[model samples]
Target: MSSPRGGTARTAPPGRNPAPQPAPPPGPNPEPDSTGLVPYPAEVAARYRAAGLWRGHSLPAELMAAARAHGDRTALITPEVRWSYAELSATAERFAAGLLARTRLRPGDAVMFQMGNVAETVVTYLGCLLAGIRPVCTLPQHGTREVAVLARHLGARGLVLQADFGRGQLPEQARALLAEGVIEEAVVVRGEVFGKAVGYGELLRAGTGNDPGTLPYHSRPPEGVAVFQLSGGTTGLPKIAPRQHEEYAYNGALWGRTLGWGEGTVVLYPLPIMHNAGVSLALQPALLSGAALVLAPSADIGTLLDLIERTRPQVLPLVPPALAIRLLEEPRSHRTDLSCLTDFIVGGQKLPLEVAERLRDELGIAVRQKFGMAEGMFLLTPSGAGEWIRHHTVGTPLSPLDEIRILRPGTEDEVPDGEIGELCVRGPYTIRGYYRAERHNASAFTLDGFYRTGDLARRHRLGGAPCYSIDGRIKDVINRGVEKIHADEVEDLVMRHPDVAHVALVAMPDPVLGERACAYLVMEPGRAPLTVATLGAFLLGEGLARYKLPERVESVDALPLSNVGKVSKKELRQDIETKLAAETV
Candidate 1:
């Protein structure tokens, strides 16, 4: 945990900082709201869960059932093309048969697929299901380096990859890995074919006339792993989180119900389908509930908005940072025909309370915050709630088979209600441990059983509903020795300054003290008076602890953001460390 990427460990600001410590943690019994929905205890949550209407089944079975029910209905719609359920099912069946004919990839055999957001990606994923091949979905950024690491660790037999991803050539890198005996076979999708690398078209041809009915091989048990999603790779190398068939299917159904999606709903999946939110909110829900999925890459925001206008989707799932910044910069006139949008589901990153308010007040759209990770455990603010809670709270826990506990970080003791603690969860869908990393798993999980979410949250009642509010990340929180300052709180305070367009709070190296908060700011084009002292005064006036106040402020043209539109704190922290080192010299 000591500066993962080679930067000095951060510490509190140097000075006799006088700020009152946080109030004593609240006791278990909090007053309920007038509607009897707020401060809902475990008993009340149990009542809501007691309906016993949860859908727990195998993913393949659910896919087949949907295809049978809506044979000709449009299932997946891309900008360039449209695919009917029948057509997709047929194609997947053929592709699965082709995989079988080409390689000895049988049930339980892991195959790594490095793909982007495209139609072929979906087909490949479905094909894996039909063949009972465990598909490990990876980002386009992953080349031989990542693929080889994961392939060797997972004992992968095959690699399905896009020909060109960004600047990397899949054929060349894949060939290197193959030569090194990392991966046995390679199935290249998109563009030209190569020696030993079978093109998608050629492979599918072998499976032509394949019976769609016999597809989605059922040799593996329902509880067996179906998909392998990599962890955030925060602690040096990444770890694979395997998802089971039955629980994965159940997650989709539960998510569909939470979103209030039915057969007529059309979801816009602009992000990569490999992501949990993209799959759960858009693809899985659409497929399981017989709704239509609109696929588009999120790289081009304008194009995505255009697609939204054309498709008239009912639900739009978006990560907060990108859309929030867009809505702030772009005029209302640019948002075309969003009247069809019922709710804009935001997740993956911190959703500023200000952004939520603006969307609700200006666009007249509901901003529902959802919190989840790839390993599983989806907690959503129940859909169609009052505007206040939907905008602020991340909703209640949705999974019927899930259990949640907020324990003091570095300790097994559970914190009292209304107190921030590390969120730990265990459930049918949530992975018990990381794949092939006994050491990592031993560190990540509890003695009994629970995947530490690494997120700091507090139980809260908002708009008469019981839910958890994300304070910030344990890793990202600036530890000021005597007190811990959550970056989100600091960001929220600094964002209130009209001159500041966006802000990121990162820990900078300190001499005597361990670390001090360094503010990286993006200001309005003509805005001025952005200095270290000015920002420090603003935080002090806002009642932030002196240690919590930014000791240094670096004004920039714009904040560095990740591909997903979140302020890349990881990158920002690095930048600050570099600056600190240079200044020290």
Candidate 2:
């Protein structure tokens, strides 16, 4: 869900860690501004620049470099189209010029994007970067509430959406947002023309720039905001994190080197391109490394498997456990020739170690567990770290310049190295502040400038390198009056059970205790229902405290996932409340 930017308990803004940088330099905006574009402190910015971390390079500049270095190389492959490095570079420029020529969109104005894994999203995202437009990446699953809040808050200049998504929801939401003066224009892809909707393809063709490669607007500032990604997971109101160009570029290239990315690396992306993980961890890295990015038509297991068999990509980034389960059970997965794939980068939510083991042992591939956030922190198991590090932890921070602290909850004091505490971090890649939400920033970051990541973590050694183990988010705890039970700790225990296929422990409201633990389970076919007493005994035997035990047990065929593929505790909590309300009636 959301890392409460302020203090709702559900929060994790983005990624961070390394040695603590010197006290935030005071050169940048001396204080937070109302526009919500929080600039890094002056001293901090100067330090990074001196350290050679904040190079004056933007994403469009990187694309131009890629085109120059590997002009004839295949750069992008989607079911509908394929483009080489030169072509991709030219297309990005064309799309940029087209936006300038056709749309009322001005430089620095925000363009809201709601699309799937299709190539159009990628094209538009890069085009926005090149055109000096900030791409606010809203998920395809976001509904009216998220759209309205984001558009209105960000003052989005345009809405770029997929015609095929949300039945008729996005278009209606776009119209409403426009009516409320939240958006100025709407651009639809592969859908019917309605109102002032402009066709995506038509927009790209409207370009007539003779030399589109030249960096317009004085080469675009390296520290300029590149895009807006939803902070944390898909569980709460969408909070936009304005990622800067130079720092964002560094992390993407760092990931390539960390994962041993090279010219031959072929990436298959199945997640929404508008997501932080997709753009930062996959798309940008792939392009910079001279790799080909193959965009799957959809996240469907069978469809992805067919694409993998045909494409034989070297790296497959991001595998959610549910999709892993589906992949394991799917008949095509057994026969699919995925031998070329060397690493399966798993993230979105904390992936159980067992899933990694299965990916390697069962499927004969490597697993790189990653912990990435929209606000700019990225941790992934490196390519040559071996399986021990990959299986034991989510690996080290992508940037050595990233600093991390395992602080006791709600405090800046560091805990014992091996003990669990809130993971607070700040780095070159992580956002200094959220866009336009000044009230939330006060509680979101510490006085020293570290972001208080609401996830529980402990530092551990994997070989000689330092790595951290995530102990679930602080918001995932089930509060029983004075006592708190970590949902993941209980879910981990339940997941070990022979009959349980998947389990999610969430807090259920209780009149006296305020909240109690409820275990939502997905079991193997024909398994008997799990009783609260049975789970309690199992947890007790496993040495969990009595207060930590589940008080209610519910079973479903599958746990509902958010639009971004996170286990939707919001829905589970709602279900529990609904059941309780019905019981009272």
Candidate 3:
């Protein structure tokens, strides 16, 4: 078959390895470019390539190869569409060609995505890869403030938005951004185009007559930046992490293989498809392994149950703790024929043992725990793990090359086994630094190159294998299901209110969401106490995402402080926990 770049595509004979390519000459790490992308150190890159961990193939080429191998197999399924491997590949190429033909966008340009879980999202994402455009995987819930911050940081060239999202306000927002020159172009999906915006369908039609084989696809090396993943915003604004084609692909392939996904495997994902987890865990893995991916438009329990009944997916890859709780609580879940499901992976927050046990006992399905970040380290409970390990621990690293260290918080000293400490890691897939964050990178990574995950964990030996259990987080961020709310970001926004003297956002224990932000405030002298509704309204007006708004508000005389003069969040957390326990009683 011809390559997307108008050349014959190379493939090895079946049952044989591909011929090795020559490596680049030894040298120092390349300087950061205008895009703020830092290349892996020369020796490190060579080591990964030599170990075959960093395969020298672009993402688009890998997708095309999968199509060639599984042409007739169903690859994508949504409420309104069902695309086979061949059709998905052809349509993606058409979209890629159309993007170049109909718009100013070109290969290597960065485009921000603000779409939902739908077939068009997959098509547009894959098309961007094929056209050599880098997608900034921003969530639909992101408001103008967040989007503007990310767009400005990455110098994003365009945006792909779901017009119907956010009560049809997304289109207006996109148009405003275009008018303001914040972004060069906007592509609307599932909505009418207006004022310098193009319809997605129109773009696809524009390339119908063009031959994809003759189009100039992305020519960058496999290690080149393929997409931008957003950090969980431990500090404040979400930082961008540039994911390369090789490591990102390796991430998905490794997870898919670890879970034993095959062509017949139907994987159902109900989360936001544009998020990093969605792409790495669901989209790439399923497509690369020739597995069928079922896209549930929403995470509503009823919707999820109905999709499971129809799709009969063997894997529900990235379920949050809240969704798992809702599924078990929903009456329809009992009636749904979930026997086809073999693996139900849970992550994004600590899964209560009760929830994991109930899912396993009531559903008779293997419940696997996962711990991952957009920065690239992934840990998952093996499929064959025992109930204790699966219920209590997040399991081992996905790659054998992954190097992990447990260090004392705020120091580089190693922590003994079974002792709680900060998790630090370096691996073939883990990123060395975030995009354009030079100052933050110094503290985010160790001098030796390990990325310091702000999570507290402890080493464990479960089922005769080394495992890790998440104890807590050292970062001041609240994990509310799949979305993380930066405490400082919210506190800063709340402090904007004239009546607020001081505010502290802390995670309150939640049975459903695992945790919800509760705002404790010391109001300005003589000011009326803030209500949850009033505070939420204030925050929403301040351009914070609805998910980040605090669910509860409390009046405090003063916030506890540590000996270092910092807000004693630990004491506040304990106070709130005690209150919640008393209320439950």
Go through the candidates in order and give the clash count of each.
6, 18, 0
Worst 10 residues of 3 by lDDT: 1-10
List model 2 lDDT by residue over 1-585, tens digit each: 111221111111133222333434322233556566888876677778776667777766875676679888888999988888888777778888888877798888888888888877877888888888888888877776777677777778898888777575777777887787878888887677678778777777787554674536337888778788887543344467888888888778767766677777889988777788888878998888788899986788888987888788888788776777777767767777778888887777777766667677777877778887888887776667776777767776766567677888988678876799998877778888888767778778887677888889888754465678788998888779999888878887887787888888889999999999989999878999889988788888888888888899998999998766678898999999999999999
Superior candidate under lDDT, 1 versus 3: 3
Model 1, C-alpha of 103: deviation from truth (Å): 2.8
Q: Which residue pairs clash within candidate 3?
A: none
Highest lDDT scorer:
3
Candidate 1 lDDT by residue in tens digits, 1-585: 011111111121222111212211222322323321112233422333343322344577677788778888889888777988888878878888888887767766889877777888888888888788888877666657777777777788888888866665777888898899988888988766777888899779988877765655655565567778777862455677777676677678767766767777888876678766666667777888788888885546677677877888888766566566675566742455678888778887778777787766777767788888888887777656776667667877665335667889977778876889888876545766676665666668766456788999886645353577788899987776667778889998998888987888898777767778888888877889478788888878989878788878888887776655567788988998987789889
* Model 1 TM-score relative to the real fold: 0.87
Evaluate residue 452 in candidate 1 and report its C-alpha lDDT on the 0 to 100 scale: 88
TM-scores vs. true structure, each candidate: 0.87, 0.92, 0.78
For all the candidates, what are their Cα RMSDs to the real structure?
10.7, 5.0, 12.3
Candidate 1 vs 2: which has more TM-score: 2
> Who wins the TM-score comparison?
2
Which portions of model 1 miss their true places by more than 4 Å? 1-57, 213-216, 234-237, 332-335, 462-465, 481-483
lDDT of 3 by residue, 83-169 (tens): 999999888888988899999998888999989887888999988888889999987877777787888888898999989875988
